[model samples]
Target: MGNSYEDECRRSLAEEQAKSLAGTNNWEHVDRERVHQDWDVLYREITPFLDGGSLPGDQQIQEFVRRHFDIVCRFYTPSREAYVGMSLFYAEDEAMRAFHDSYHPGLVEFLGAAIKVFAEQGSGFAPSAGEASA
Candidate 1:
């Protein structure tokens, strides 16, 4: 099958959403090397919002993971069949938790809303409350 414009649009939207959440147009600066070397910095920079508890951080994580992981699943068919993978790594790592906690409320809410818009306009993959249960 061929890739669709909808797919391209979804990816573009996701990248934009992630960039806005990170408060930088420089997300390209984030990669495995950066994630490994500066995770603490990234987490510290993004946590307060995740911890605010006004909006659900887990749900935001779920949607982000789902949209990104779906692209992975299209290539690696056996990785899993879920919209969002287990989020097991996020659960097992303290730094990941800290990263989630660091998100500013405004940013987190914006991300959540953007994810909702992406789902509605593109994928229709609304994150169930249970998906964020972890």
Candidate 2:
């Protein structure tokens, strides 16, 4: 059989992601396995807040959003506007929504909400540890 829908989405997203990194030296230091591990941790950590019916702006959920932001910063530093836009993309992009929801139903929406909250709060631009801001 051919790849599942989720697999196909992942493959497609990876290609798009690679293109987004073109000409950026930041990708040179990225550890794919470590980034994946961090994302797993983020998803696991955030699920409880979603399951408990916490709102996106809840203190706990916002804290997790900070972690999520740092994880994303591993690749590139996104402006507040860009970060908010990315959150929206997660919900609006069919493939992104499908990939995220494959982990947990409603996860994409929850994460998008929390990310918007984080961006709205004007969180400082702190890249992940050891990363220099561009």
Task: Give the root-mean-square deviation of each candidate in angstroms.
Answer: 13.9, 9.5
Q: 1-134 in candidate 1: lDDT tens per residue?
A: 12353344344445434444466444443454644445344435444545565343355554553544444333232112122222322333577444544544244333433334444444434333224633
Candidate 2 lDDT tens digits, 1-134: 13363344344445444554785663887888998898888888777777788999999888888888888877766655556657666887899888778778989988877776787685674332234668
TM-scores, each model vs. reference: 0.27, 0.72
Candidate 1, lDDT over the whole model: 0.40
Error of 2 at 74 (Å): 1.0
Q: Give model 1's clash tally.
A: 8
Candidate 2 segments exceeding 4 Å error: 1-20, 126-134
Which is the leading candidate under TM-score? 2
Residue 95 lDDT, candidate 1, scale 0-100: 76
**Model 1 misplaced stretches (Cα beyond 4 Å):** 1-31, 37-41, 57-83, 92-134
Provide the overall lDDT of each model, using Cα atoms, as 2-decimal numbers. 0.40, 0.71
Per-residue error for 39 in candidate 1, Å, reads: 4.6
